[model samples]
Each structure stands twice: as C-alpha cells, then as structure tokens.
Target: MSTTTPGARIEVRGLTKRFGGFTAVDDLSFDVEPGRITGFLGPNGAGKTTTLRMVLGLVRATAGDATIGGVRYVDLPDPLRTVGAALEATNFHPGRSGRDHLRVLADAASVPTRRVDELLELTGIPAAARKRAGQYSMGMRQRLGLAAALLGDPHVLVLDEPTNGLDPEGIRWLRGFLRRLSAEGKTILVSSHLLREVEQTVDDVVIIANGRLVKAGTMADIKGSPGAVVRTSDRAALAGALRVADVTSIPGEDDTLIADTTDLRLVGDVALRAGLPVYGLEPKRADLEALFFQLTEGTNRNETAATAAPPEGDAVTAQEGANP
Candidate 1:
C-alpha cells in the first residue's frame, strides 16, 4: 500500500486555558498546515505542553477550540487513525515488553498485528523490541513511543520533545524520518526546546511566550532577510557611513561590524562613498536559537513563577492509559 496519506490542517481558535488565577494558555491562535511540519516552540512551562494537551483533548480548555480538519479531537471518528500523539516517552507500562506495549495499543486501536513489527523495524528498535520497557534506556523508550504513535498510520502527528533522549545519530535519523513523513503528506506539530534541531527540521513555526502567542509564520518569512556582516580597516569611517544611510550596526569580534540592514548594495555604496577599506562582507541569517531568545525573552514571567509553584491543573498528566 502507498504510504502517501492525505494530511489534515490543525487550527486553534482563541484557545485559552487557565488553572485558577494562573493562566496556562492565553488566547492562543495558530494553524498547522497540511503536508508540512510546524514547530511548536517556547521555553519551559511556557504553555506549550498545556496547549498540546488541550489540542489532544487530554486537558479541557477554559475557552475556545482546537480542531483537526475542523473537527475537535474528541469528535474524531477514529482518533488513532486520524491523529497520533506521543506527548512523553515515559507513557508506558513498565512491566510490558516494548513490542508488547505497541501490540496492546494496536489491538486497542484495531490495527493489524503485522503493522506492529513493521513499525518496530521502521523505528530501528526491532533488535530490542522484546525487552521490557522498564529495562529500556530513555532513547529506546523514545523509539518505542514513536512506534506506538505510528501504529495506525495516522494522518496527523503531535510530538512533544521527541528528541529528548536521542543521541546525535538518532536525532539525525529522526530528522530524516519526520521529513519523510511530511513528504507523505502527514501534518506534524512538534513541540521542542531544541531550537537548532527544529530549525533544520520544520518548515514553519508557532512560537509562544508567557502563555500567549508571540510569533507564527514560515521559517523564511519569520527569519526575514539576511543581515549584512562587514569588516573594514577603518571602523570609525564605516560606522559613520552606516549612520548616514540610516542603517544600524553592532561591533563584532576582531573589529568586524554587523549591520542590521538586509540591503547589501546600500551598505556597499555607503562604504564605497566614504572611501573605507573593506576586508569582507557577507549576509548572515539569524539562527533559530537567537530568534527564539529575542522573541521569548521577557515574556516568561508566568513560566518563571510556575517553576516554583505550579497551579493545581497546570501539570500535564496523562488522564487515560491510551495515548491521545
């Protein structure tokens, strides 16, 4: 059978979740397009997990709705086949073998038994599939959770911190695996703090802070244009020229200057007119880590407070034994 399944769009409309006086998610809104991988990002306790829980119907929202293909997760005809989720790697019965764990889930979801072995091999865990989950390392457990998520060949995937226990090689493998699933038209929303890895993996991003929407867009659009990095023998002259052109610049190591404007020609012309000796000039795009910090810096007050005393309902507990 062809693996290319149709994907569904995920829409969150004015979603809000409050636990007593503290708000976990505040009027957040974003869409995860079909056939694309969207990175759901934020710092620790920034409501990312809470939002995903609300989306998966594991937690109730105070107001608004989260939908997959315009239908709430609770109303899906077959949630297992429609949306596969692995919120955490530890959601397993410690006594059960890894293979048996997936088999139990597949049976509950009415998935074929052969597909369990298929996923075990596909996730590169067949060698240890018979080992008890209690004996599996964190990385091994992550692979097993992923295998469980794919048991029904779901059209949409929601993964939270999927790379937590992976090594470099496993992380690289997961990047390729997620890309392949996207190529097969599965809508994916991955929540992770690994900004560098997410940058290389996702096509779009939805960033939140302090339980509120901060930024959301395609990677290129949000990163915008590349800034100009220039090195000149005459630092003072270059700085003055940049000022005349209304462009701002910051000093870099080894006396290099990083200009804030995307227009290379403008910087070049100003420097040329000023008769500054230019050593090097190049465009530099802001990495995801820098951008994430810039966007979420001061908006994490609630996140900070939650670290000390989280509200009663703020903790993300798996309500049912089955994966949402």
Candidate 2:
C-alpha cells in the first residue's frame, strides 16, 4: 500500500451545472470530512451523478468548483494516487480479462503487478480474475471495478451506485469494507439511491434535490431534531398542558401525542401538572428514509414548475397559441 495520508477533506462550493437551458445542478454546496463515509444521496434525476461527475472533473461545472484537499481533481499532482474512483461497474474494457484489466491500470499508474492480484483478492474476485470482463456477472464486475479503484491504495474513494448489482451478502460485505476503510482514516464518498443501505453505512450525509442541497449533516444531527412520542390518558389535556409549557405536541397514532422535545421527564412533568396520567413515553427517532422523501418532494415540484415554464423566446408564441 502507498504510504500517503489515508484521508482528505472534500469541499464543494456553489457547484452548478447546466445542460442547455435546463439546470442540472444549482449552486450545490457540501463538505465531506475525512475519516468517515459520506453518503451522497438523491432520488433518480436529482443530479447526484452530475454533481459527482463535476467533483471528479469528468464534467465541467458551469458555475462552481469541487476540490479534494484544497486541490481540484485536475490540479492534483498524481490524481490516482490521491483519489480512487469507481463511477460505474461496466467501465472496464469488456474484452480484457478482469485481472488483465486491472494490470493495465496498475501498469499505467506505475503500481506493481502484484498489487493487481492483491486487489483482485481483496475485492473477493480472485477466482474470476482470469474471466473476460464481458463474461463476468454484474456482481463480479462490481468487485472488479472496486478492485481497480483500490489498485492505487488512494486516500479518497468516490463510488456511484456501487451496490446496484450486489447480492445481500455482497452488500453486507461492502458495508463492512467501507466502514473498515473509514476506521483506517480513508475519506469515502459513496452515492446511492438506496436510503436503507446508506442509512446503515454512512456516518454523514449530503442530500440533494433538483441539483440543490436539501440537507447536510451527521446522522445524529439530522435525526436529533425529532422528539419523543408520549402516550397519556386525556390526550387533549396533555396537548394543552404541553402548549402551556411552550412545548408543542402533535397528535399521533393510537391516541398518542408527539412532543417536540426528546426530554421524557419534561414531557411527563408537564402531563403530571395537567393532571393527565402518563401511560408511556418513547423516543421518536426521525426515519432517514422519510426525511429523504420529504426533502426530495420539493425537487419534484420544482422540476415540474421548470418544465412547465415557457422558454424566454417563446412567450409571444405561447400567447399566440393561448389566443387560438
């Protein structure tokens, strides 16, 4: 393995991309810290791929910039040595054997030939190393792609939809591998549409929609905003009491009240003062999937609005058509 530092911070500032008149990414900004897995999450067509491409210097941004360790990808002295990227599973030449494909990359990067075999084994595809990439299964191809990414023993890893074709076991293995890498101080930025998988794997998240940032923070910081669910006799009284105490309570299922604070004792005390018997109080953790949906819903709405808007030069044409 290379003896370079294991992690580097990634910074995206006002990163924007436009395709003709349609904006694909709009001033999106977020930070991916070192020594942790940061999930780059968005629904389909939310510009997650475009943003990643911009970060990797694969796609030029119209308005902003992204950098790793304060250096743009193109400006890196030795890019592959600093950043390893696996954007797609089928990126390898189809005719080449998986081992040969890695060897080619290793040769180009000046990495030792034995490192190719080591990566094949590390990614758990040594048995199929001799198979043509065209004949490899999707899962196997993913493994090979990951092997190629790790060939340089880079400090930073950027992957897009890496779990797309993996079986449950493969996904589980990947989760563990990423965590172990993070523990070793590698900076990891993995993009996924799979919220459940990301929720389990990532330490922090940057959620975007309509090419704009929706939310960004540690998992705890995001989930910490939600409060507790309290069940009490006389739900209406409890609500009134909580309101008096300047704590808001929303009515929940099964005659329970959801308070805006996680403090169970405070909620119980308010209920006691209201002469309402507290039956139960359970912490209501915010569901990451639910929050993801909530944030992206506006993106869909904005997309619709943008799509429906008349082009700048078509205002007269639209008026003429409307009159007809």
Candidate 3:
C-alpha cells in the first residue's frame, strides 16, 4: 500500500463552509505544490482548521472544492496510502500503549506490522512505545500521532499545529524532519499559528483572515520587499535629514529609525549631510508575524467569521484526525 511517489499537489478552489448562520471558511483558494512545505496560517478563529477539514473531506464544503492530485480525498482508492495527516495530538486511546495505538491503525490500513515499528523509531518515540498513551506528555503524544499518520507511507502530509507541544529541541527536530520529507518530494501542508515557527519551516505560505484568503506566495516573494533599520545618537536630526532627501523614515525599536527602502548608503549619506554621525545601519526584511497580524487584525470584528469546528464524519476521528 506504499503509494509514495513524488508528492502530489493540493488545490483548493473557492472553498467555503457555513455552519448555521456563521461562515467558517469563505471562498478560500490556494495551492500546495509538491516538494515543498506550505504553511497554512491564521489566528485562532481564522478558519485554518476548517479549511484543512474541507481538504480532507471530513467536513462538507458549502461551496467550492479541495483536491489532492486533482482528485477529491473521498475519491482516493486508498486514502491512507496517498495522503497522511495528523491534525491533533490527543487522538489516541489513553489506555492503549503507544505501539498498540499505532498497531490498531496499521491493522485498519492493512499496513505491515513492521512498518509500525519503523514509524515509531522514525518519529523518535520508541522508548515510549510500551507506555500507555495516557502517561505520555503532550510532545510524546504528538510523536505518536505523527507515527500513526505515516503508517501507510503516504506521499502528501497535512499536519495542523504539529509543533504545539514540542519543546525547543523537539521543535528543531520536527523542522528538520519536515524539510527532509519535502526534499524527498512530499507535498506537506502544515497549519500553525506560530509565525516564527512557520517562517523557519515553510517555503510557501497561505494566510487567511475572517475565513477568507488574505495572502499566498513563496516566502522569498513575500519577504523580498526590503527595508532598512538605521540607528544614531541623534535620531531626531536623522529624521529631518531623511525628509530633506525625500526619503521617509519611521520610528523603530531602540529609538532607531526605519526607512522604507533597502539602500543603506543613501541613508548614511543623508545623515552625513545633516552632520549627524551614523551609529548603526542594517538591512531589515519584512517580518512575517507583523504581516500576519496586519492582515488578520480586523477579522475579529466581522460577523461572518466563526471559530473552526471539530471535523465531522468517520474520515476524522478523535483518535485519528485529531488536529486538522
């Protein structure tokens, strides 16, 4: 059942989900290309999970469609072997040992038992394999959930907040692991509210707000719009000089000034002309967290938005699709 080919692309077109009067997802559209890790990011109530559930076919969309390899998730001949997903960490039976929990999923998917051990070791939880899931910490549960998701050796991975409980070391390990998976040509979509974490882990990003698409692009493309940070003892003098030179400047941290352009020399020259000594100047890139907040700021005031609901149907169980 190993269907691991060069990863397949994921497409969402005009995807929407309405619960009663509230629209949890609104005409959202994006693409997750093969051989890269795409971050699906939004604030807590920004419909990130709802969108993922629609992609997995766990929740019916009110409008539009989500496809994997150009086919709906339900239409896949062998879903587990084609797309592996871990949406939550607490989806296992508390009474079951970690290994036994994976064993059950392996049996359901008709995966070989040896593969279970392989995944256990792959996720770095072999030492906890004998412990009941109830005794495991949040990070350990995350590892177990990931191991279960990989039991079928799928090509595409859709993980929602996989790093929530990881310590710094665990987070670093997960980052390297995802990068390696992408290098192997797997299409990986990871949903996270942690901007710094996502910035380091993903090559592309699809950000949402008020259940609607806010932005989507490669990280480089998004952050390439450059700026510069300049520091000087005479901050007020530099500001006047920059204005005289037709360059705009804004106040920055530590009483420094932030200029919209990336050219540091122009700023330095401007300061020199004003007889202000240049203390420090450095190139600054757009901050992903700032952009995320900027885009999603007013979403909370919109009445059309709603918090993501737990997925419906057997496609996602508490013990199976716990996080998407």
Candidate 4:
C-alpha cells in the first residue's frame, strides 16, 4: 500500500553542528531517496544522533540545513504526518502502559486511536500492550517506540538504532517489515552501530568519521570488486613484482599480502617471474564490517572523549544519544 504522498526526498547539505570549540558534525551532506532504506553509520561520538536531531528540528544546526521534500522540518505543515522519527526509544512515561504511551502521542498528533492499536499489532507488541512501559524489556521498549513512529503512517521514517534491543528473530522480522515499507514507496533512514545488520537491511549506506562524510553509495559500489590474498615466503619481492604489473599489495595476516586486484592469473604470473614461493592464494571479500573499520580506523572520537572532557555544552552534544 503506497502512502498518500508516497515518500519525500531527505536532503542534508553542509549540515554542521558545533558546541563551544568542539565540532560534532562538520559539513555533512547526503540524501535519502524515496522508496529506499539508507543506513546512517558511524563510530561512537561521530555526531550521528546530533545530525538526526538537527534533521528533525529537535536540535538546531549551527550551519546549513536539513530538509525533506525541499522544506525544512520546522516548516513542514504536518511534521508527524510527513516524517516519523524515533531518535530515542526510552522517551516514554514510566508509569504509562505500553498502549497508553502510543495513545497519548497519537492524541497529541491528532491521530485516530485505532491507528495506535493497528501499530501495536503491526509492531508485534499487542500481547504486552497493557503492561507498564517501565516493566518492559529493552526489546519490548524498542517495539513500542517503533509502533509510536508508525502511528502517524508517515511516508518517511528516521530511526536511530532502531534494532538496538531486538533479538535475532525480532531483527529478522524488522528487516522484512522495513523492506515491505520500502516496497510501498516509503523513505527510510536508519542510524545504527550494527554494521552486519545494516549491511543486510539497507539499500544504501552513508558512513561518516570525525563528523564528516567518508562514503555514501550502494553496497556494491562501496565494496568494489573482491581482491585476493596471497601468502608467500618472499612478500617484499612478490609485492614489488605485483607493483611492476600495476597491482598494489598490502600486508595481511602472517606473511600474506593482499593484492588490490581480483586477477589471480596476473598475480600468479608476477610471483612466478619473481621466483617467490607461493603458499596460499585465495579471494578476500571486503565485508561491511571490514570496510567500516578500514574507513574509520583512526577517526574514533570515543578515544579522545575518554581522556579529555569537552565544555558543558560540547559534552551534552557529544554524549547525547550515545547509549548502546
């Protein structure tokens, strides 16, 4: 079932956020196309939540703009009916029942009460709908938060760590659910730390480091072609020979060298010409987890945050939504 408006394009241009002297997000830019699920990924304290907050108009940006359908979030006539966002799953009244929590939000958003029930069932939390929110497990709380996001039936969804507390089965169910929504022409942008899960679920990825955009593209485009790992007794000689053949090689486990090309015949010929004893040669596929670490290796902000504390305002911007 397509939404009334299908889905709107989400554009973030030069989105920057700063607190005091610390720059949380610097000149970030990306787009979430309609009918696709985009994964917003980064290391800890990489300003992901801050960016999302700015996009939702919860936190103002120091520079640039985040827009949906070419209009800023604050300017949307019916914000909830256009974009549904759940930045934090724990933002609920402790004493309120699970069902009541959604009902309350729905009422405030002018949504029909029946929509709440439908979302409750849709998110698979109806069995515990009457239980107090405080008594629910993290997984249940995640489900409740998802149900709340869908209560408006918006064409766009912005979820930060949406699968945070889900079990394997729950995660699988959510994968299918999101795919169905995308098939119905909804726009989805998910911020998550689970690289493997995001790799499987999202149609595209927007990876950042040190509050700057590093990569944004389809999975295949980013991963490129599979390279080969060659183990040899004389790595230096083999590397030199491969370099002469216009192939680059990097150090790998043991005495193995990782060649940047998938042409095994060329690698073998070069090594043989150099008289290097080859032990093992195999294809090395760069998975999402590997590529994520490779791209963000030295850009971790947590390492710095651990030793030095930022100013009061900076601290809040850096630590907000940092919970795992």
Candidate 5:
C-alpha cells in the first residue's frame, strides 16, 4: 500500500546530487508517503546512499530538492523531533553508554529526558543501557542506534541499509521493528541496495539504477506487473498444459503444480476439466530481487558484475525469472 499519513510526506522533486563530475542521483523524483515503510533500493553504485543524503540535506543537491512535508529537513522545527534518521550505528560515540547516548541527544534536541529509558527498553536494549557503545555487539549497536532515532518520537524515519551487518536473528528483529514503526503512523524510508533483504520487509519500493529512477511503487504494484504464480496438485500435468505460460515452476515432491500463472481460478478450472486433481493453490509472488534484476539486468551501470562492491554484483543483485 502507498504510505498515507496526515503529515510527514517526503517528496523528492527531481533531486539531483553530483559527486565531483558524476551525477549520483540523476534527475531523481519520487514521493515517500508517511505511515508505511518505503524501501529505498538499488544496486551498490545505483546511488541509494547519495539519494538519501540529498533528502536529508546532508549533501547539497546539484539540481532539484527534497522536502519533508513541504519544507526541507533542516527547516523543520526541532528536526530530530520531527524526523528520526539512523544512517549508521557507528555514528555514535564510543565512550558513552547507550542510555547516556540517548540522553545527550535528547538534551541537544530539547526533548524530554524521560524518553531515554523508554526508548532503550522499547528497543530491547535495557540490559545494555548502561554499557558503553564500544562494547556493544553489532546487533546491540544497531538496537541502540534505533533507540536513539525513536527517542524523539519522530514522524518520519530515514535509515540507510539498516541491516548492513548482523546475524540472521538480528536481521529478523530489525525487519519486525521497522514494520512496527511504520504501522504506528511513522513514515519510514530505509535505504539498501539488497533487494532480497528488503523485499519482504517493505510496503513500497523505489529502485534506482545508474543514478536514474527505474521504478517506484508499492511492492505489490511492482511485483504484480511481473505476473502471478499459482500452485496446484498436479505438477507435470499443469506444466504440460501450461506449455505457453509466462512462468512455470519446477516439480516438487508428490505432483504439485507451481506455475507463474496470473489467474488461479482460471488455471484451476482448466486443470479440473483436464482431470488433474487440485490439492493446493498458492501464488509465489515476485520479490524485490526478481523485479530488481529485471530493471537493471541488461543495462551497464558503470560498476562491474563483481560480487563485492559498487553496482550490481551480489550485494543487491540476483539473476532469476528466466525459467518457464
């Protein structure tokens, strides 16, 4: 669903940011509505970070502008109280305890001190509230950073690759945390090039490639365009009958059909008439990874196909959807 909050609408009107001579965000324009999680996605060098910086006013836009509720981020009254951003956990001070860190930020922003413990406890870091930031684990540090962002009870959240480094459990926790925040009428714009990671977590997605906006819409809207997937009881029978289907699935145990058919009822009717018993009918929706590759697949985007760094290697790129 498109994010729809009464306030905190983030509009990027042709925001262009240049790094030296290169345009990082090339004529980029999109709206990040409030009250939903907007997954900011792209390849490594596709300019996700640069685009976020423009929206936050951390980097000057060489062309257009990004506004938070009709005003720039810096223009907001008590910016931190209105917008909560966590670009990196490492941005915190090492010597301070998690509680102290939040306290300091509250003091600086003139927010109530009572919010410090509440946020620490809310993020499940109450045990480590007194622990120094330098001693915290990656997960703990992330939680601490999140607590800091929530301290002001902000309306909009801007996070850059929030799940950058962590174990599987940590990733899961962060996903739920972000969703809960969005559910509470907070607009969340999380930046990450890893399409697969953000696919299940976000309500909407904005994909950029080669510093240009490629797609921006709800996760459902983007994946819906890719088509539909349906599963039934007869795999081989369905596959044989759907020889001309846009997408079909591999055979699993026990003769179950998994085909990327847009219409399930239609497929079932055809299968029933063809004498194939139907057991299960499910749709395997296209995720962010599949949709992302389709958008940036054949195009050259300055960065090579290396799996380690900038651009679409593996950090945020996956190759699939060629099967039938």
Candidate 6:
C-alpha cells in the first residue's frame, strides 16, 4: 500500500461498528492532519460518538483502526500523556467540584497538581472551581471537561461535540482556545453537529452520514468550488452599478452586496470607492458546513456505501447544503 493516507497523517482505516445490526458506524475512512483542528461532523446519529468511542478503545471497532500520532490511542505509552480527550460533558461526576474533578484526573495521569489550577484559570472557570459540578451549568461542565482534558497536556485531542450545550460566548472561547492550541502544533480532532460553528473552528473537516465517509479536505477544498460572490455595504448603488456588468445582486446575510464578478478584487474596489462601502469582497464559496450537508444528503447513500465496503477499511461519504 502506497499509504495514500492523510499525507504524513493521523489515519483511520476502514472503521466499522454495529449494535447487533444497528450499524451505528461503518467502514469510515478519513485522516486528521497533524497540528490542525479537524472537525469530525455529521447529522444526528451520524456515528460521531461511536467513532470517538472506537478511538478511545471504549468500544472496539468491529473492523478498521484509528491511530493518533501514528499509533493506536490505546497502544500509546501513558495514553493520557499522549492524547487528551473529552467525549461528553455528562461524563463528569456531578458532586465533584471543577477543581477536584481535574485534580483527580491529574492524579490519574500523574500531571502536576498546580496544573489543575492553571487550567481552571485558563478555561475561565476559576470561580466555578469551588462549586459542585452538579450545580454547574452546561457551559460550566463543558469547561470543566475541557480542563480535565488539558490536565495531561497531551499532544492530540479527541473531543466529541465539545461545544454541545455551550453559550455563544463559550463557543467563541472554545474556537479561540482550539485555534491557539493548533497554533502551538497540537492536533485536535473534534466531532460536532454544529456545522456553522465547525466551519468557523476547523482547518479541515471530515464529514460522514449514516456511519460512512463522505468528504474530507481542508476548508479551501470545500469552498474552492464556490464561485465569486461580490459584497459591498451600499447594496443599492452596487446593485445599480452591477446592472451594467449584468451581475445579479442577490440578498446575502451579513449586510452584503452579492454579485457574480468577472474580477473579484477589481469590482469590489470599484464598488467601495463608488460610495458602496465594500466591507469585504470574495468568492461566496460553499464552506465546510455547506459542503458537509451537500455531500451527506440522500438517505440511501450512507447505507449503500457502508454495505459496499469491508468493515475494516477507511470510508468517507459526503452530504452538503447551502446557506442561502
């Protein structure tokens, strides 16, 4: 095998799972790039959790394998030290304080005790550290779970729906935090159904539907196929001006002036100086979320692909959608 793998990557080859014919996940193949935040995404019951479970060895794969940093997650020495993971916020003990919860995990991972406090502050949960976890809100629990994941300072993160119930502020924080971690060369693999949020967070995305591979690529790949979309603040002038060029002005969100442009930058600049304040101008391409839903649609596609492949190899199927 030439290893046509994920390009010097973290590889998942032919992963499959079943709950006595339920086939939660099947023959999903994909790779997570090193030092990037990769979104593992799908609709409800898309096997996101089941895939994470297989990676954690919590549920054995009926076939295929997932390797982190070139080795199986379980086979890594001091698994916690090699990988940090948070599969579910509900996994935490409700009675434990945020600080104590992290402390226990730190002890288990043999991480320094001071590290717990550092993370409590790092995650903006220092005040909540003393409060009982059970009393914490969904956002608080999610933060605590993140703190626990960081206790080991692992190189790679295997997170499942990390922002599941977080508020917008919390979601924004997670995005920035994950971005910072990736900047530090940490590899993050997070599975989420929040496609728009994932579109903002992930450098690359691996989309699956009904337990199979659909599409996997950098954000650019998803949007590369999207043609030019011109935007300006003065939609009326730009729209009127664009009539001469025959580019249609469609209503786009974000106070935009949309048109199909012959020259993206050229027309964008002309429109702005023409008193149509161009806030931004570029191709309105299909982003990860759009590409995800675009590729993961058809109800039978997932089943057809799953049944076509062996239970032990990698597979990817795509469903996509457009915002407009």
TM-score, per-candidate, Cα-based: 0.85, 0.82, 0.83, 0.79, 0.77, 0.75
Which candidate, 4 or 5, has the higher lDDT? 4
The lDDT for every candidate, in the order shown, is 0.87, 0.83, 0.84, 0.85, 0.73, 0.73
Worst ten-residue run, lDDT, model 2? Answer: 315-324
Backbone clashes, each candidate? 0, 0, 5, 0, 1, 29
Q: Model 6, range 105-142, lDDT digits (tens) per residue?
A: 77865778999988999899998889989998888888
Looking at model 5, report the run of 10 residues with the lowest lDDT sum.
315-324
Cα lDDT tens digits for candidate 3, 213-245: 989999998786577899888888888888888
Better of 1 and 6 by lDDT: 1
Candidate 3's TM-score: 0.83
User: Which candidate number maximizes lDDT?
Assistant: 1
Off by over 4 Å in 4: 1-5, 226-284, 306-324
- Writing each residue's lDDT as its tens digit, candidate 5 over 16-72 gives 765545566788999988878899877777878767766776666778888988988
Model 4, 234-266: lDDT tens digits are 889999999999999899989999999988888
lDDT, residue 135, candidate 3: 96
- Give stretches of model 1 more than 4 Å off: 233-275, 306-322
Residue runs of model 3 more than 4 Å from their true location after superposition: 1-4, 231-276, 299-324
Once superposed on the true structure, which residue ranges of model 2 sit more than 4 Å away at CA? 1-4, 225-228, 236-254, 259-282, 298-324
- Better by TM-score, candidate 5 or 4: 4
Candidate 5, position 233, lDDT: 58
Model 2 CA lDDT for position 81: 73
- Please give the distance, in angstroms, between residue 13's alpha carbon in candidate 2 and its true position after superposition: 0.7
